[model samples]
Target: MDDKYYTFSYKLRGDYKASPQYFFVGTHCANEFLDITKHDPLPLFNPLVHEQENHSPGNSPSSSSGDNKRLHPFNQELLTAINMLCISWDIIPKSGLDKIITFTRRRSETPNYNGIEWFNQIVGKDRQRRSLRIMIDQLRENNELKDLRFDESNNYLNERDIVNNIN
Candidate 1:
């Protein structure tokens, strides 16, 4: 059970041997964890799942109303904004966008506040196009991705648009 003497190895060693030559196996997820060495860790941040969803923005809730109706958490709101464009077919898109808008308006005293900077960072530069690719790929046979594109409608509000309006 000496961790230092034996780094974790892919092959279950029947007998102990001190050798760096052993290939450390990727995650036990098999297909899911395929090629771990070439990739970053699954949970890439202190708060992991959030980052996987785009970022690990930590969050909690507060409300001026005290009624809990508008008391949605901050991270949830941030995530909601990001989801407006970079969608996933898994679950919660329209609702996520609503939460984003609602949370920003309620929280930010600045009329200049918009979620675009964050959105860009989440999906990376030109991620809007990347998001489109993801959505389009979802339509293919192998890419049964969830449908979460926000621009499918003319009325879809965007954070960058809001920022432009404020500016």
Candidate 2:
């Protein structure tokens, strides 16, 4: 199956409403769940490989030895949905939208969604909530910068910061 790319855009708030941020997201059609149990082999599908080299510098894993943990079932479902729902996006530093950043597949030596650790890792723990819409909204509301640049700056309001306030 061929991968398809679409131009995704989100409008900023106030004066920036005229010019929205643009992103190129790649997606495919066939991703229906077949209810594979832990014993069943994972389905044969193309994993999301990024085309852009926009990885965030100094973005090391927050986890360490013996820190391996699993998420609650409800949180696991939400994480899985966010991870696998979108294939690939161009933005990187805005990692709240990246797929499987906190937790990874079992085979990759990270916390597996179906592992014995019970899919460990809280979604928004010390990080932005894994969401695009919420991120955009927070960017509009939190940041004084009208352009919505994701650079390392205090002016920009990260969703992680606001999420803590909400909770």
Candidate 3:
């Protein structure tokens, strides 16, 4: 199948509209997929006491929770949807998993979906179809992903790639 079919763009709708945003999820577009995942904040699943550490450049995780109540709920459903797509495509790296867990822990303290209107826009019928198509194409391209197999399930792909390159 042509790789172009796997790429998709969705319109962001709201009282304040912006230009259309595109996302690609496929074996050949790992970087693009990571770019999107990295930017999209995941919901904080665990309640960590190191609220101040999140803001600090290099602080211990053992710090006390300061103003932890500020954490608000972002588009967790969207994050999960993206994660399932990543898993289906075997694109998720350890960094991606860490991002999922940490982002959920840190960003959940102050959930902000304003920067990611596409999360909400994806709920629409048309946009949902487009997103699902992208995921479907990714699954079709990777046989391992078809059976729900993950590449380097323990270690993250990005870190593993970096280590292999350095070696």
Cα-based lDDT for every prediction: 0.33, 0.32, 0.36
**Per-residue error (Å), model 1, residue 136:** 6.3
Q: Candidate 2, residues 1-167: lDDT per residue as tens digits?
A: 33443333456667652544556543331111112221211222222233334322111223222344443443333343343223222232133332343334332443332321221222233254444334434544643322322222111223234322111
TM per candidate: 0.24, 0.20, 0.25
Question: Which residue window of length 10 is worst by lDDT in model 1?
Answer: 42-51
Better of 1 and 2 by TM-score: 1
Q: Count the backbone clashes (under 3 Å) in each candidate.
A: 5, 5, 6
Candidate order by lDDT, highest to lowest? 3, 1, 2
The digit string of per-residue lDDT tens for model 1 on 1-167 reads 21111112232456444322323233344223434444332211111122223221111223222233342234333444344343334333233344344456465543212353444333443334454335435444454343433331112225324322101
After TM-score superposition, what is the CA distance of residue 59 in candidate 2 from its true location, in Å? Answer: 32
RMSD to native for every prediction? Answer: 16.2, 18.2, 16.9
List model 3 lDDT by residue over 1-167, tens digit each: 42221334446667234444556554335435535555322122211222322432113222323423343334343344445544444553232343453455466655433322332233223323444435545555643332322223212323434321100
Total colliding residue pairs, candidate 2: 5
